[model samples]
Target: MSIENVKNVAVIGAGSMGHQIAMLSALGGFETVLQDINEKALEKAIDMLEQRMNDWVNKGKLSEEQRRLAFQKLRTTTEIKEAAQDADLVIEAVVEKLDVKREVFKLLDQYAPSHTILASNSSSIVNSKIATVTNRPEKILNMHFFFPPLVMDCVEVVKSEETSDESVQIAMDFCKKIGRTGVLLEKEIYGFIANRLLFALSNEAVYLYENGYADFKDIDLIAKKALGHPMGPFELMDLSGIDVGYYANMELYKETQDPKDRPAKCVEEKVKAGELGRKTGKGWYDYRKEVISR
Candidate 1:
């Protein structure tokens, strides 16, 4: 299907990335449905989108009328069928697990229109793994958005071996229509492009910290001051969630079975303690005491 023909969009899972993708779809004039198994998460997603729209109005980036229209285009539901029934495009943004993603795609394939393009927002797990469980592998591709989809400009469009060229173009066009720069990958890889570079740096950073070379904060300082990075590895982990990075590393390790690909001891410990970064009020930094207290 062509981008122009895709009038309805379904975003499965209403976590951080899913909600933002749904908001962008609504902003792009598509009738968008945001779906999650948890009603509370869906409610939170709607609240966040409304707050963001209000912020845009306050900043004069969006008119009140435009904001109202965007909300009109957005709908929330807990029912998977209700969300995917007539959707021309379905974006799965569930947790980073291959089995879970495959299950989501299987349901999507059952409910979504036959011509609907199925895309995943997975950062490390490729779409091909999920596509194999569905009947329409040709329609499946990866449309991996950044951490915050509304703010990020670049989206990685990954084509599996079974993904059709037409489906790839439609996915690219959809990204452009939603005001994101689409970087197309002809073949699927473990981390795509950006995540591969990011994980490599983070792995080394964790090694340095564990080996007692320097404190995480000092390392973060060096990355910001010396490398001109906006945030240090620890800071970025706090913002993005230590659990997220840890799971991504585990996914890579499952694929490669390399000892170097294992999750860092620090990451595993933080996750075990439920200190999952800003969302949990703690991670590499303690947020409960002070805002991002390093």
Candidate 2:
């Protein structure tokens, strides 16, 4: 089906990325549904979306009528079938695990209509691996959006060998409809474009920190002041969730069996300690006090 055929959109996660993505879809004038199994997560996502929209309205970035219309277009559900049954497109933004993504696709394939295109917002695992479980491999591709989708303007529309050219074009068109710049990748890769670049920088930063060459804070300061990076690798890790980086690295290691591809000991330890960054109120740096003060 063409981009014109896409009228209903389902976002199958309510976390940081999924909620913002659903908001963008709603703002783009599609019938959008945000689904998650956890009731609290769904509630939190709705609350966050409302607060963000209000902030945008206050800042004159969005009109009150636009906010109201977007809200009218968006809904929430806990059932996958309810979300996907009538959807013309499904974007899966679940955890960064291959098995979890495969399972999600299996359900989306079963519940979504035949014309519905399924996309994964994965940063590491390729869509081809997840498409193996679905019947519509040609409709499955990576629609990888950066973290904090509302602010990040770029999206990677990655196509696997099985992905049709029509599907790629449709994804690109949808990205434009939602106010994002879509970069089309004719071939699939492990981390797509941006993340692969990020992974290399992050890996080196972690190496320096782990080997006692410098502290993470110092590294971050140098990156920002010297290299002109807005946020250092360690700071980026905290914002993006250290667990995400850990899991992505582990996935790469699983495929290549390269010792260097494995997650650094410091990262693994942080994950083990349940310090998964800002969402958890702690990570490379503690945010608990900041949260409390706020």
Per-model TM-score versus the true fold: 0.97, 0.98
Report lDDT (Cα) of residue 172, candidate 2. Answer: 96
**Which is the leading candidate under lDDT?**
2
Worst 10 residues of 2 by lDDT: 285-294
lDDT of 1 by residue, 1-294 (tens): 578899999999999899999999999899999999999999998987888889889999999998999999999999999999999999999988888898888899999889999999999888888888889999999999997788789999999899999999999998888999999999888899998998988888999999999999999999999999999988888887788888888888888899888998888999999999888988888888774311
Backbone clashes in model 2, listed as residue pairs: none
Deviation in Å, model 1, residue 99 alpha carbon: 0.9
* Residue pairs in collision within model 1: none
Instruction: Report the lDDT of model 2 for residue 21.
Output: 98
Full-model lDDT for every candidate: 0.90, 0.94
In model 1, which regions exceed 4 Å deviation?
Answer: 289-294
lDDT of 2 by residue, 1-294 (tens): 788899999999999899999999999999999999999999999998898899999999999999999999999999999999999999999999998999999999999999899999998788999999999999999999998899999999999999999889999999999999999988888998898999999999999999999999999999999999999999999989999989998899999999989999999999999999888999999998885310
**What CA RMSD would you report for each candidate?**
1.9, 1.4
Candidate 2 lands at a TM-score of 0.98
